[model samples]
Target: MEPSVFTRIVRGELPAAKVYEDEHTIAFMDAGQVNPGHVIVATKRQVETVMELDDELAAAVFRTAARVARAVDRAYQPEGITLLQANKPAGWQTVPHFHIHVLPRHEDDGVTLGWPRKNPTLEELSVLARRIEVKD
Candidate 1:
């Protein structure tokens, strides 16, 4: 597999404010942080999302993210933490690789994740759920 920005960081191909690294994933400080102690955890492989990842790889990445988040929490002591992983362009995935953003939340921080809520009727929900449940 070709190297990603994350893979490069793991291999020291690129310079990053890295905090954690393991065989499967790497966690680094986000240069453009929305809040203090913001971090990004990413896999060395190029899978774009959880659905694209095998179970073992996905578990590894998630575990790395959790560990990083715990440390960030202890270090920064933010009121909360937000873990975000978007898939594909339509879902606002900027990179073609998998990553989990660990955003430390603070009341004074300007970061906001807002979307207009749309509640579907029970019948609509049932139809959508059934359609999604039918795996190939």
Candidate 2:
């Protein structure tokens, strides 16, 4: 399969403002950032979504994300951080390859995640928790 743009960046085929890179993944600053210190962590593989990521790979990517988030926190010291990884187009995933965005958030940054809170009943929460527990 042809490598993705992110994979090319990982393989050193393309130049990036690289912050970190490893055998499995790479982290760099976003070219068109919504805020300052916006970083992207991507896998060397061309997995299109988080669901396609294997457990070990997912964990590694998240670990890289956490490290980059900590750095963003130290350098930018924004109000908070937003870790976002969209899937398909329905999930606002523009890139076909999988990647996580470590957005350094500030007050009124206009990068709303739009995750509305749902006050589920206790029974619903219990059922959902049980379902998740069953997966382990």
- Taking every candidate in turn, the Cα RMSD to the unseen true structure, in Å, is 2.0, 2.1
- Give each model a TM-score: 0.90, 0.85
Q: Which of the numbered candidates is closest to the native, going by highest lDDT?
A: 2
How would you encode candidate 2's per-residue C-alpha lDDT over 72-122 as one tens digit per residue? 999999999999989999999988899999999999888766678999999
In candidate 1, what are the lDDT values of residues 83-125, reduced to their tens digit? 9999988898877789999998988678777899889999998
Which residues of candidate 2, in runs, are more than 4 Å off? Answer: 115-120, 124-136
lDDT of each: 0.85, 0.89
User: Candidate 1, which segments miss by more than 4 Å at Cα?
Assistant: 1-3, 134-136
Error of 1 at 21 (Å): 1.1
